[model samples]
Target: MLNLPKEKVIFAGYATFFMISLTKTTNNRLKDKLKTKSYTTRGG
Candidate 1:
């Protein structure tokens, strides 16, 4: 029973870390995509 809470805490920590990294990479990809789209629009 005592180990259960400890396991939950560890799981939550990893979840938070994974979410943060996922968002960071996705945000960068969005920015790059937008930049290229805008540049192409302006050039054409």
Candidate 2:
């Protein structure tokens, strides 16, 4: 087992969670944009 300080561990956990959430939101935005583009193209 690797020993780490408590603060460092918590920071790492928060950082990882933040990054995952950021990526998820970014992906969702991209998907939304693609969907809108498709809809407009179909309607036009």
Candidate 3:
């Protein structure tokens, strides 16, 4: 009962952070893929 509200609040906070973190992680993944492709093409 009481725990439900707290859980919801905590979930909301984490959800907000997750949205930002997800974008960062996605960008990092794309950068990593580009690096890999460049390295393969350059034979390095």
Candidate 4:
């Protein structure tokens, strides 16, 4: 077990969580844009 400081461990956890959520939101936005584009092209 590598000895990491407590604060560093907590900070790493929060950073990882933040990055995951950020990626999810970005993916959702991209998906929404693609859906809208397809819908418009289909004349919906």
Point to the candidate with the largest lDDT.
Answer: 1
Using Cα atoms with residue i matched to residue i, what is each candidate's TM-score against the true structure? 0.83, 0.89, 0.63, 0.87
The 0-to-1 C-alpha lDDT of every candidate, in the order given, reads 1.00, 0.95, 0.98, 0.94
| Tens-place lDDT digits, model 1, residues 1-44 | 99999999999999999999999999999999999999999999
Worst 10 residues of 3 by lDDT: 35-44
Clashing pairs in 3: none
Candidate 2 lDDT, 1-44, residue by residue in tens: 45568778999999999999999999999999999999999999
Q: Which candidate is the best by TM-score?
A: 2
- lDDT for 29 in candidate 2 is 100
The number of residue pairs in model 2 that clash at the backbone is 0
- The per-candidate count of clashes, in order, stands at 0, 0, 0, 0
Q: Supply candidate 1's per-residue lDDT for 28.
A: 100
Question: Which stretches of model 3 miss by more than 4 angstroms?
Answer: 1-12
Under the 3 Å rule for N, CA and C atoms, how many clashes does model 3 have? Answer: 0
Please give, for residues 1-44, the per-residue lDDT of candidate 3 as tens digits. Answer: 99999999999999999999999999999999999999999995
Task: For residue 5, give model 1's deviation from the true position in Å.
Answer: 1.0
Better of 1 and 3 by TM-score: 1
- The segments of candidate 4 whose C-alpha lies over 4 angstroms from its true place after superposition are 1-4
lDDT of 4 by residue, 1-44 (tens): 35668778999999999999999999999999999999999996
Could you tell me which 10 consecutive residues in candidate 1 have the lowest summed lDDT? 1-10
- Which residue pairs show collisions in model 2? none
